[model samples]
Target: MDRKQIINDPQTGNKGEAFEAYDDIPANPNLQRTIGDVIAARYGRRELLKGILGVSATTALFGATALSAPRPSAAAVSPEQGRYNFAELQWGNDETHHVADGYDADILLRWGDPITADAPEFDVMNQSAEAQLKQFGYNNDYVGFVPLNEEGSRGLLCVNHEYTNEEVMFPGLGRQDRADFAGMTRELVDTEMAAHGGSVVEIARGNDGKWQVVRDGKMNRRISPLHTEMTIDGPAAGHPRMQTSADPTGTRVIGTLNNCAGGMTPWGTWLMAEENFHGYFWTDKLDEDGKPDLSEQPEAEQMKRYGAPGRWYAWGKYHDRFNIDKEPNELNRFGWVVEVDPRNPDATPVKHTALGRFRHEGAETTVSSSGRLVVYMGDDARFDYQYKYVSDGVVSEDPAANARLLSEGTLYVARFDEDGSLTWLPLVHGEGPLTAENGFASQADVLIDTRLAADALGATPMDRPEDAQPRGDGTAYVMLTNNTRREADQVDAANPRAESSFGHIIEIKEAGGDHAATHGHWSILVKCGDPALAEVGAEWNPETSENGWFGSPDNCAFDAEGRLWVSTDQGSGWGKTGKSDGLYGVETEGELRGHSKLFFRCPVGGELCGPYFTPDNETLFLAVQHPGTDGTKALKGFERASTFEDPATRWPDFDPKMPPRPSVVVVTRQGGGKIAV
Candidate 1:
């Protein structure tokens, strides 16, 4: 294969399908604007009035009058009600996790930590599939802390192990090379598979207010891709497209793959998103006769648009189930949202198809005024559309009844309008262009080919939509992670930057404060960039103040007081500058509205993720993924080899002799008070 072809192909490149249509459209001279011009034209008038009144006009229109009230300037919180105090930290590229000055942080869990008695202690040079199955998986992404007792001292810490950094996971597997395929072994492949799911570990807060994992606790369990069984539910469960030779019923799968950012449901189940799972399979593997068997696949074009490059990992060589040419339907069974009840270890995890399927980032849910359950989700691929699933029935107090609600909801794709308004285009069968004549034969077909249906309906394509978080005040915020492939003509009011190296966050006010509302109004909350740079800076000019600017916002969450907290995933551009990926907090309301401050920074080459807060808003838990993943680039004398001999980063363990390992970090105030206060 030509490296240039792979580099230029939207499906095979770093931009993924988000830039699939970039070359097809020409640049629009009128759409091009300098950073200052764009910021002034977009927020000048609105922010002027907001600055004077200390509240957005839109917030007033929505009747959130409390947001306009005057408040203290210090970082103080009421014990009864969780509120955030503003504090700023300077950015640095140190090989350690940095937190606010008054706050203290410590590593809570690291990859390969033994969760059960059967699991062996972590041995970097001698890891096995069986050992990994009983331990914490690799690359923890989303973190959810669910209290088991009323005092909140005991709880279940649920985390999603997104994907493995193969080079770092195995002992001698340096940078990935085609020649290394000849030396791949079953043990290596199995170990990789065992590290791709989620983990539920029992945790207890000590008298000192620090959290620790309880080894061999009753709730401690690892849901790995090696042995866990998952049930397929919803309208598409028994569809022929999901059937496979291994499971003729088409209603069961062996495991979950690429479990990324996730959320905790109101009923207390973990909703994990299966993202970038396609890269694990080998679709174009050669047959016994040395001929490509994936040439005739019916959904070849569709698969390409979903970023299925021929044989990236070639796991098919070790496992027949991963060979798409041999079992095409197996790929279809992996992209849905899988829900797990941490309280019941024996409960069967489920993949809810009613939410529809793509490269799901996760599902953030809120109940509508009418009592219907509404779930907001994002398709993490570039140029993909944002979606939401609105349950047809009302939520119930019974957990069993609530579990069935997601299996019977309507999935809709978003279409942002030019006038700062957006409409949810329902992807229901027999609706508008989604009919048999257009190839959608049933509801399952519509759900299976969700992206195609959305494209046919002319839904607006967005920069990689990462996380959609809803606030208690009836508005939701969606992050459009930077789209480096966006052209001038592709520029829209919502995504104003052409080659958007730095992304923006959009605030959506659901119509009538209803989560189930089909029509909503939206506005760009912040156009993220370096405030010191004149080309793509924050509108408020944060560079002059303690509040520094950031880019490529990935995972986000709202604090107890409804403040927006953002974490960045800076791609290949890491380490070129002095800045490392970090977590930042911004005031969404009151006198400090529109102000952003850097709260914490990850180590070199690490992306900050899973910024979840405790119910009391005292402790903040976050995941630092892929630290020192310089990958052959010798930046600051750090080489990208994954072997323990020539490791790039020795994080968590600051020893210069050890290799870097991804881990979850917990942050809290040193004086036993609320965080950020």
Candidate 2:
């Protein structure tokens, strides 16, 4: 299920759903058999001559029956705790990009911090695109800086603003319509569009060794959907599937959406993910001339599947263009990893169509030990696929070569065997399992519409997969955000838990932990749950083994010591025990499979996101989002803007009455000691 499907309170998780599903296949042979029988047995009267056909493809990807016993280790633990203080706000709001040995470089920009003179200076009360484009912009998410000097002196900061808090960014939501009937009025739509993407700013260190945003810096630019242009690459480029009135040739599309936590290529580029693009499309039918659109279309179902756009947001007016029912191919342009070369702002951002897209959380890239470029990406929706694209064209560390390599590649969707081994199956045309009738017209179609292509190819359905990060060696870690709709019958060897409450972290090794192996090994390294809180979701029912809960795992990062720092999205209502959201640094090594120590806790209403480690591993930066998100009360009832008290979750010092403030936090030791060993 995608993010739109809400799980209400106190419902018996995944119980109301049917035992058999059109999309999912149960792992139990008996259940599969029963499902087949039930379909035939119940539909006997449908037709005298027709017979029911069972699932045509149910190959067992999981081999060896079960995963080996859990092997906990301390070597895998995160160094976040030992190195940095939990509650310190390092250098923040300086209007300048500066870095020092000790922490002080937290909250770098404000909502209206000017990027150029044309962009106005900070004034929260009144804001505009003219000012925004020129200013530091709002709500910075993922921050990646590439050091210009070997001594780590200067670099570039690439940050994404997931979305805007319109109320806070605009004056009284100004005449905007949030109605879903007609997707959105142009005015209202423009406002939302402006807030969707990221920014690439040039930063340099002064004689004092401090980094500052150099206005008019040669490479400084803002890449937003409202104005940024992108080029199509790999499989789906120029395909009929992506054709729209906007770009009838199907070769270009405007802007990327909800660009979140991403990775920097070893070859010197940034891989920004399109997280919630589905939210923008409206599904109602209407022609370009505003006439009644035809109902019969080749991609009607596909349009329905991707949120049936035109659904309104928090505001109340409507424009109908987002309706994909009228324009089925429009929605196809999103969900792919868009690559940006910060060095060349004018270079069209390349949508690496080879990597399948589905609520793309982020991507991690590494030149495998064999020296091939392997891009690992996840479809954030529950039950989506984990994909890796290996360029048919070999890799080179040369910046120019790497930029051209991702444009052409062999994409593979992963399948986990029961024996703990995983295989990256071919997702190209004329290859194994991908044929014309199976909905894959060609390799390009399979790559562009990867979710459907993976389903056709029998790719393993995973819990919400977000941010796949590769460790120093070849092992990769993924944050499997919890899935509350899974049932006992759905639990397979790899997934292990049904209706898991606390999401888990998955560890994947390419064969011998080689970054470039076509085949690999996989296992759940850690399951989130409070050891003392007792079991939260539905019990294992005696027959099913108890898979304890940790909370939901979001983005993750590795320090110089090879430890895993996990951020959380546990503040959502789906969490068990209603625990306060926080960040955890796990130290995994011998005998420490899931030892998660609380590293830093966001304010009560905040969620910790974007855990990025500087290249030197000297600093850990995190984004604290929506410190007072529960600000639904009337303005009269609204206390001062920083109302994060009443429910204390003080990270560093643990105070109760402190006002909630969302900012980036940099952690370092007081006396220069390694953090979190």
Candidate 3:
């Protein structure tokens, strides 16, 4: 199918899924060698790791040079042995979410739920933009906790509301993007803007060990794209390209949008990573096929590289700033990590420009062994690059002093080699190819057009890298989500499968156990898919059950004990796996390495996200987004578009008057002890 046909197809459920199809065309320009060619050239140790990727895949991902290095300290001698002790939950598609046998998954917050004491109760029929600004935002993706007390019983919850699902989120409005957005009005667009960005609320554990929102708490606040004002900091803060008519200073911008996976800094700050910002931009001009027309745009080349003026939302049609024809530089102000202080509501959020702009999936931070702050990031596109930002200043006990770490960091892109060695190429202006001749006139210019600069630096193009989590031991895990659009001649060693359905994970051990190091060793942790299919090249521990294996590893985290937990988001493609998206605990060390077990499962059409565990490991928080709308066409009996008035399931509340609201679920043990001990 053609690009326009794929996005306009009848099977396309929502604009988000349509955007995924729209992004099938990669932004990277260099694709000389495919994965098949590399695998065909080298053919050693292909049998040893058959336990993982099978013989169909060669030793390109797990070469001897990297595998021969010392394994993790917790390595086990057998696949059946590991530290996790919970009974695996069987996976299946259903209308309601499911958890393990010994856990209680309770709904803590839902879309439009009243979060402030003065906020009115949610009335779906009478929804208004003014009301949504005070209530819980829609489609929560990232869940973070900041402790407010010594016992860790009381804390502030920071959550990111990714995007709105108009089909299931509104009353009479059907799919708008396919209908030329005729149904989208100014009020609806304003409500969607109010729903974007992040939320901060105070919570406390009761005597019964249940967490409840403190509606009247002093820290309760909402950060929305409609009205939230943010300050820009770092090298590219005051660049000419960042200036707009409304903001001549070029150091301030209004609100954050498309806030996806985020992180909690060591000094108690929330890092909101912006993804898919290009989709929110609007363009009045369209070609004969109704696609964005950028022929006469001044910054057409730079905007096309990032897929700007995506027309995913109608906000730009109603608001001048979002309209690219009027303010071309407004698009550049976004796509960076915004740091927010959860403890203080009045503090203005800062967009750290030192962390290069891209479709950032996650901004997970960890203090290096030498005390410098290191943030592991992934650009979530088909052939985008993974990045790292190392702070020049060391972290100290003072919380205020650590706040500047992100603003003064050196950004580097990864270059994974076939020899299993990884190199971090610095994206420094006036260094190497990043000079005046290559379009980088200054450091600010390099930071403004990060993707263009990285392309010149010879960075390795990855297969949809998303949500990288770095542990205290300087070991980082990267989730390479599947890239089905990959053709036969476009594959590489890191991404071995052409037309890859099931994605894989890469384990990186930083050089000298330092996250800020310039070098590292990378090995394939697991090639995720059904182990029963050898043609799929899936590698799993013999102990993995039918329900243990999963696909499209999206967001991931490490528990207090250093165990890796992954959440999947297959969208409409979940039909291929015949299982609902959920949370899985995969063993990364010792004998049980590559073994996976299902812990929690989402309802049909819902994507699991933000699997966060408390410091005590007693409470696990998960975000179930866009329930009952994603891929309902693949559902066995319900084979049609689900509207807000006629959803497949009324989850959480299950009330006939309510729709399937996106919610945040809190999972706790039955008897109130450390989980899965």
Candidate 4:
């Protein structure tokens, strides 16, 4: 697939085609755009300042002294104070990770790093599927560090290998050559499959405070597309839609693909979201009868709305499971949150279907006031709805009991009102439009066609909702990544920008400070873009300062002190403004509220993901994915050449002659006290 072309196309880029396909369907009249409009108009200016600053004296509060001086003590200050005290890093095109002045960063692990004793060392020239399965996979995105001891000396580092950059993975192939899928070798396809999934490696902090992977640790494991048993659980499990020849019972799946932004469960498990799983399947090809098989499928329209393509990676040529024509039900088995227990290497990972299937960015959980587990998720596509799953059972003290919490839940899609309030529309079978008359025969059917159900409920379409995270203070923050295809008619108070190229962050304060609140109030945290392009009547001001402005906010996290940290994924827009993708810190409260600062910049053509902070707030971990991807340009014909002898970014290796490797980086204050203090 030509990723660059896909991102550039206004109609098809970032799931635009899917949104258009579902746009004509009438939304529920009760959930129309009136509420969003009223909310935006009423709070456009007044609430914008108050929501962020929490005080009236904005100018006096955010004066030079606040930006220049050290923060007050934790007890005397707000959560944002002292968390982002570092100087903002400047924008640069360098092929290296740049951090703040008082901090140091180093590569902790890279693509192909050995995770087990039997795994061979990384050798770019002699790579194989067997080797990749025993090593770290490609494109690390969501990262979760689970501590094993109170001292924080040893921990399990769980990283999601979102997808592979095939052009860079192969020795001779480039983007242009990737179009000739028929000419590609099966071994190459297998290798690519081996590189897609997640990794679990034990890492330890040395006495010197640097972190390194424990190669021989018993907990070290790699779950890839090549070989892994994932049990399907919840409403959709055992349904006819999920049954395949390989799994006639419909209770098992081969592996998880395109695992993206993820979260750690309270029960000590990793929930990896299968984002863009549709790109791995080819559905529109001819069947044995020489007819377009996708057109004959009962769920064809649903597949189209989910962004199923005619021919994508062409993995079907190498594996029958990836060919929808041969195994039509295989695609239905994916696109759910797969749970993996990193602490137990022998455990069988599970695909939780109660969360409802969509283009999931990932799942973040927060305990509701009622003691139920509230799982927040975003379908990572333009115009997709944000969803939440509330467990019917209360969280249990026993890990065994808590593990089953996600299996039974009520899935709800969000509807933002004009008065800045949000409602969770139930996507249950027999509920409103989701009746048997509308093709939903059971709860499983409703969960399987979650997007359709949400659309039927008139859920507010968002600007590519990516990561939804809850803070310790009961409010959750969601990153609305850029959506260039959104039109003026689709704009609402919640999604104010018609063509949201730069994106924004939204703050959701759950009603009664409960994560499972069916109703909530929301506010725009920041309208992220170059301020010079700000339009009239904008609800919030665009980012103005050179030190703060950024675009395409993707992964996010809250520090121990409650400050928000964000990372940018600048797809094809890399280096467009001479600014590279970076990690940023924003003050959500206190005198410096609404102030954002760039903390670290990624290498050329790279995205900064998995911005996780340790419990002690002493270390920050980030994933730099797909550096040097822009080295080659697409050509008219299926032919191209590498821009240089090696990849454009040598990054952590710091060698121009070596291929750029995506790696996990750790940052800490040089003086060894708590970070940012």
TM-score of each candidate structure, all chains considered together:
0.87, 0.76, 0.95, 0.88
Q: What is the C-alpha RMSD of each candidate to the true structure, in Å?
A: 5.9, 10.0, 3.8, 5.7
Quantify all predictions' global Cα lDDT against the true fold: 0.73, 0.56, 0.85, 0.74
Top lDDT model: 3
Instruction: Arrange candidates by lDDT, descending.
Output: 3, 4, 1, 2
TM-score of 4: 0.88
How would you encode candidate 2's per-residue C-alpha lDDT over 456-574 as one tens digit per residue?
66777777787788865788887877665566554432334556656667678887667767788765555565433333311110111121123778888777767777777753332
List where candidate 4 sits over 4 angstroms from the true fold.
1-83, 176-178, 284-293, 488-493, 535-544, 630-646
Model 1 score (lDDT): 0.73
| Runs with alpha carbons beyond 4 Å of true place in candidate 1 | 1-86, 177-180, 285-294, 541-547, 575-577, 630-634, 637-644
Best by TM-score: 3
What tens digits encode model 3's per-residue C-alpha lDDT throughout 308-338?
A: 8888889988999999998999999999999
Cα-based lDDT at residue 456, candidate 3:
85
| Model 1 agreement with the true structure over 1-677: per-residue lDDT tens digits | 24334334423212211122332221112223222233334444344222211345334322243354433333332222223454567777766788878888899999888988777888877889889988888889999989999888889999999877665566666434334255568888888888879899998889998989899789889897779999999989989999999999999999898888988988999999987776676755545542234568887755655555335454787777888768878878877899999999999899998988788887888889998988889987656778999999888898768978889879998877655577899999998999999989999988877778887777766767889998866799898877766655544334555667777777788899998999998766666775445555343322214335677788999876667898987655553335788888755554344446778998876788899988888888999977766322434665433354555567988665457888999998887877765
Tens-place lDDT per residue, model 4, 450-542, is 888887788877777899999755799889877665456545445555555677788899998988889998876776766444351222222
